[model samples]
Target: MKQDRHVSPSVINRLPRYYRFLRDLLGRGVTRISSKELAELMNVTASQIRQDLNCFGGFGQQGYGYNVELLHKEIGSILGVDRLTPAVLIGAGNLGKTLANQVNLSTRGFRLIGAFDKSPAIIGTDLVGLTVQNIDSLEAFCRRYNPKAAIICIPKEAAAAMAGDLISWGIVGFWNFSSYDFTQNHQGVTAVNVHLGDSVMTLSYLIKHMDGFQEEAETEDDA
Candidate 1:
């Protein structure tokens, strides 16, 4: 396993894409693939693919390229997909229910041990086979299950206090959808904050600029 911590975050981010493509290739009975071929499939340059993989000690041979199955396994190991990480969800709202039902958490190395909510109405409800527990029981539940990660789907106003509570109960990682900056509030916490509104805004910006780019291209072609 590549244990280098010096790898850039950009390179780290690209590893999952490499893993996914490799897995798909393996599924399609592709035994080996050259960097150029993989790059073409991923819409990236061959040199960029080589550079990203090199950060974790590139597996491709000069003539043989990379073994699809082996590369998938290596990237999986790097991403800790083989390890089952216990996690708990901290809300039972519409978004939370959707995530619980739709996300294949176990396939991606996480197991949702508990789902929680403050409302009595939602407390006893079933969410993806796990019974929704009251928020008051969070501390005891965490102590019992000893989950390493917390999935925060509560409102932004309630996020900080819940995060602090989870951190006190030994949760080290957070998948935050509450739009609260957990990392900023708590130093050394591993957090991935998902802001759906921000993502939509970003996509809207890209689409607007891409239309402008196409118009410019058309004008240049006419000229």
Candidate 2:
């Protein structure tokens, strides 16, 4: 199915969550589900689910709900989850090690073909089955594998230079965990800047306001 170019970014952002939920459904032997059922599971409204899926050329039926496997596959396809784009991690530090090892990169759209770091002590060490090559060897490795994506976990100071190097070296997609924002300069490239601190701070805000939010909702219902 062709993608809707006019789809909102908010809808696009929800695709991964939809894909994940559908995958879970498939794993649990759920062969079919209605929009209402799905919404209940996802903490959303049935109409919202219908609108979002419809934006992608609605695969559901009026009476039969959605075929779970088909919906999963379609959402996965839409997000390129199964593309297995060749990817590399640029930092072999604590965060990098966790991501490369703990995360199932292949199942989540990337294949971590290489890991790199600037430290001499870390060089030649094993990281998620790949040897930690010195950052100097990055270009040579890129030439050999021609990776389309890179996972940047290095420090903020190094991210700017690394982003330029990746773009010039033909890497088009980035999963950046550095404290730097790489999206500002790269106009056409696909970049997701993962600010770990920002996320935690945002979580703090939600936690701080949760009680008030629930009280407001309760008051609204009573009114």
The worst-scoring run of ten residues by lDDT in candidate 1 lies at 214-223
Task: Residues 1-223, candidate 2: write the lDDT tens digits.
Answer: 3347599899998997898788678868999999999999999999999989998886999899999999998887787755667778888988888777776665454667789999898899988556799999899989887877777788766776676777777776564453322232234432233455534111111111122211111111110
Residue 18 in model 1: lDDT: 87
- TM-score per prediction, in order, is 0.46, 0.46
lDDT of each: 0.70, 0.71
Alpha-carbon deviation at 137 in model 1, angstroms? 0.6
- lDDT over C-alpha atoms for residue 48 of model 1: 93
For candidate 2, give the lDDT. 0.71
- Strongest candidate by lDDT: 2
Q: What value of lDDT does candidate 1 attain over all alpha carbons?
A: 0.70
Off by over 4 Å in 1: 1-82, 178-193, 199-223
Candidate 2 minimal-lDDT segment of 10 residues: 214-223
Q: What are the candidates' C-alpha RMSDs? A: 16.4, 16.2
